[model samples]
Target: MSKDTDNSNLTADNSANTTSSPSNDRSANNVAPNEVTFALAQSHFLVGDISANADKMRQLAIQARDQGADVIVFPELALLGYPPQDLLLRPSLSGRIKSALSALSDIQDIVMIVGYPHVDHHGTFNSAAILHNGHQKGFYHKQFLPNYGVFDERRYFDKGRNQVLFDYKGITIGLLICEDLWEKSPIADLKQQGVDIIVSLNASPFETGKQDMRKTMLTQRSREHKVPIVYVNAVGGQDDLVFDGGSIVAQADGSIAHEAPRFLDQLMLATLNVDSNTFNTQEKAPLTLSRESEMYQALVVGLRDYVNHSGFGGVLVGLSGGIDSALTLCIAVDALGADKVYAVMMPYEFTSKISLEDAQAQARRLNVSYTVCPIFDAVEGIRHTLAPLFNKSPADTTEENIQARARGVILMALSNKFGHLVITTGNKSELAVGYSTLYGDMAGGFDVLKDVYKSQVYNLASYRNRLEDTPVIPERVITRPPSAELRPDQKDQDSLPDYEVLDGILTLYIDEDMGYQAIVDKGFDADMVAKTIKMVDNSEYKRRQSPIGTKISQRAFGRERRYPLVNKWSINS
Candidate 1:
C-alpha cells in the first residue's frame, strides 16, 4: 500500500518538468491542439536481456512517433523484464540499466515512459524514466511494492516516498506502476494533484478471471477520479508465470474505450479529448475469452516460451491415450508446430488395446512424429534386477510403479539423446493427492497441466476439439475412464474419490484455504475431507520436486502456495 503524501511536499527527485518549448515540440502533439494520442506498447520482453529490451523500446518509440503519438508507455520493468528474482542482486545490474537508459536517450519527438530499475546511493527503486528530446525529463519510482503471492518487490526495491506527475501536450498525466493502481492512495493523490489522466504500466501475470477483476477496478477508479485511464501490460511467459497483455483504456465516465487482446502482443492506440476527458471510441474492441480459452492459451504461451527460450530443439510428450496426455498432445501441437512436437506411446503389459489405438489415431490426426515404444523389455529388466532382493513377496503397487519408472527412463533417454525437452502430463488432482510417482510419471522438464485440475483437463480437451473441423484428439480418449495403465484393469476412481467430489474438496482446501471442518461442512464426507487433506500435506515433497507449469488458477502449487514437507500441525487439530 502507498502512503498519502502531500502533493505540495513532494520531493525534488520524484517530480519533473516535462513540458517542451514551442519551437522544439513536434507536430504530433499539435495535431488536434487539445488532444493527446497515446501508444500503448503491450509487448513481451525477454528476461536478462537488457540490451535487446532497450533496443526494442527504441524501435517502438520510433514507430509510435511515426504513427503520431504524443507519448508511448511500456510495461513495468520493461528494461529488465518482470519478476527478475535474484537477478536484481547482480553487481552489474546498475551498469546494465544505466547503459540501457543511455541507449534510449537519442530517440526524439515522442515521450518514452520506460520502466527500469533505478539504482542510486539511496537504494534500488522500481522506476519509470520519462525520456524526451534527448534529455531525461523526470523519473517516477513505484510507490507501492507488492510482496504478496508471486510478488517479492520489497525484497529488492525501496519504498517510493513521493508522488510523480508531469504535463505533456496540455495533459497532466500521473504515473503509477503495477501495484500502485491496486492501492487507493496513489490514484487518490493523483486526483488531488489535478491530474487529467492516469497512465499505469503493468507486468500483471495471467490467471483465470483476472481480466474481469482488473476491468471492474479500472471502471471504479476512473469514475471516482473523473479521469481517463490508460493501462498497458507486458505479455509473455517467464518461467512459470504468463503475462497476458490485456491492456485497457477507460473513459472518465467509467466506460471502456479500448481493450487489447489477451495472451498476445499488441501496440494499441487511443486519443484522449482534453475537454471531455474521454478517449474516442474505436471501431472494435477484442471480445472477452471464455474460461476454457483463457486457460488453454495461457498453457500454450507458457510452454512455447519455456522451450524456445531454454534452447530446446522441441518437446517430447509420453502419450498414454488417457485424457491427461491426450489434452497435453493437443496443447503441444498448438504451442509448438507438429514438426517440432513428438509423441511416444510407452505401452506396457497392462495398457489397454483401446489406449494404443487411440494414441496412434490422435498422433496421425495431428500429423506429429509418433512412436510406439513398448516398455515390456524395460519393465521386465527392472523387475528382474529387483527380484533377487524380494523373497517371493506378494506383488503390489511396487511393481506398478516400475512400469511408470520404465517409461520415465525411456523418455528422459530420448530427450537427452535428441536435445528435446520432455513435457509431463500430470494434472492437479493427482498432484494434490500424491498419486503420481516422484521420478516416474513426473519425470520431465515442464508439466503443461501441473496447475490444471483433472476435471478442467476434460473441459480443455473439448474446447480444443471444437476449434477444428476434425478433432485432433479422438472421442474415445475423452469418454474413456482415466487410468495410468500401470496395473491391470485400472481406473483412477478405484483408488481415489470421483473427480466431481475430489475437485470440490480440493478446490475448497487448496485453492480456498479452507480448514478440514469447513470443507466437510460444505457437504463433503468428513472422512474424505480428512483423507484428502492428509494426502495434500504429505505430498509436499513430491510437489517440491515437480516441474514448473503454467499458472491458470487463483492459487498454483509452486510459489503461490508454500507448505512444509514435514509439519506437525494437523488440519483436525
Candidate 2:
C-alpha cells in the first residue's frame, strides 16, 4: 500500500497487526504508574540508503520497546536522511519509501514516529509517519518549508496546512518537523488544541553557538505553551554540513530533563508523568562544552563522516609546518586513526628549518606515517619549462605559485596512487582574498579549514595542544609569525592585512552581512575595509572551485553564501 494513500485514514491489516506481548519487566512501570516512556533515536542515517535506514529504525524500535518505551521518535527525514537534495526527485523514491515503511510496520506494541518524504497525487512533502503494530496509523506533513541559508526545502516539498495531533494512553501528543517549531503559529495552534506534549523531529545542521540557541528556544516555547517537549535531532556529517545531536527533553516549567551528548549517536529515554504533566529529570545531564571544545568536536565529526561515507580508505595531508596544516593533521588523526592518516611535507629552497622540524615533530608526536618530499627538483624543472615562454621576463608571484603547485602535484599523485583523500590546508582568510593558488594549494578533494579564519586557526591550535600532556602541535608552530615560505623571509601580511583586522572586517561584512560603509563606521579604517571587500569580491571564482569542507560558522562559503562570479555591483555602486 502507498504510505500516504490513506493519509487521513488509519486502519490496521488484521494479519499484519499481530503484536508480541509487552515485557513483564517493564522499565516504565518502575518509574510511575501514570507515566509514559519516550525513546529519542538520535542516529546517523546515510542519505539515499532507504533500506538500511529503515532496518536501523526497526532495530532501534525493538530495542526501545524491549526497554519499556511506549513511543519512539526519530530525527527529521530519518528514512531517506535529511537534506536528501535531488535524491527526493528520483522516480524510484516512492517505491523505496513504500518498501521502507512496510518493513517498519512490523514493529509491535510501541508507536514509531518516523520522518520521511510523503508523496501522492497532490505533491511531495517533508513528513512524519505514525506506525503502530501493522497499521500506518497516520502521518504529519511539515508545515514550514525553510528556504534560507543552507536550506531549500521549498524546492522539494509543498507546505502542509494542518496540525496533526493524536492520543495514546489518554495523553494528547502533537507532532512537528524541524522548521515548524521555529515559527510561533504551529506551537500556538498545538497549544490551542490542548496537546499535553510536543515531539519535534529535527535534522538541524550544526553551527558555532547553535546548541545554546536551541536550548533557549525550547525553554521559552515549553514554558509559554505549558507543554513538555521532546526534541530528537540527527547526528553526523553530510558533505559540508554537520548535525550535532544534542537532543533534549524540556519540562513544561522550562527545566531540562535530559540532554544528549553532542556529535554522537545516542538512544536517550525520558519519562513523562501524566498526572503532573512534567518530565522526570535524569540523574546526570551532559556538560555544556566551551566554544573551542564545541568547534573542535564539530570539525572532527565533520571530517570523520565525510571521509568514511565517501568510501576513502584513508586521508593524505600536505603538511607545510604552518598552523593550518598542523591543526588539520591533529583533526585528521583524531577523526581517522593515526594508522589511516599520512602526512607529507614538501619543502623547497625557501622552506625554513623551523618548519621542517615542526612538521616532522608533529607527525612523530601524532604517530602517523610521515614523509619529507623536497620539491627542489620538481620546481626547477617547471621553471626551466616556463623560461622559454617568459623570454627573460622578471619573476613575480608566478615562481611562488610553482612551488605550491609542486606540493599539490605530489599530494594528488600520492592520493591517486594509494586511494586516499587529499586534504587541503588553506584557511578562510586565505580563501577570502585569493591568497591561495588554484590547482596549486587548492587542488585537494577537501579543505578542512576552508570555513575557518586565520585567527580561529591559531586559537584552535592552542586549544588542541592543551588536550594532551605533551602538545601534539609544536608550540613554535603556533607562536611563530605565519608565512607561506614560498620566498625568503616572506610573511602573510606582506600581501594581506593583519589577521585580527581582516577577520574583524570579514565577520562584519560576511557573517553579519554589513555594508562596506557600515563596517568602516564601526571604528575600522575605511581604506582597509575597502581593500578587504575588493579582495573578497575578486576571489569568488577561486572559492567556487575550492573543495567542500566542514562549516562550523553561521556563514560558510559554498551553499550558505553565494555571489555572482561576474557581478558589476561593488562598494562604489
* Candidate 1 least-lDDT 10 residues: 4-13
The digit string of per-residue lDDT tens for model 2 on 155-227 reads 9998888887766655778889988998999999988867788999999999999999999999999999889
| Candidate 2 TM-score to native | 0.95
lDDT per residue (tens digit) for residues 358-439 in model 1: 9999999999999999999988988888899887889999999988888899999999999999999999999999999988
Model 1 bad stretches (over 4 Å)? 1-23, 28-30
Tell me the spans in candidate 2 whose CA falls farther than 4 Å from its real position: 1-33
For candidate 2, list the clashing residue pairs, or say none. Answer: none
- Give one clash count per candidate, in the order shown: 0, 0
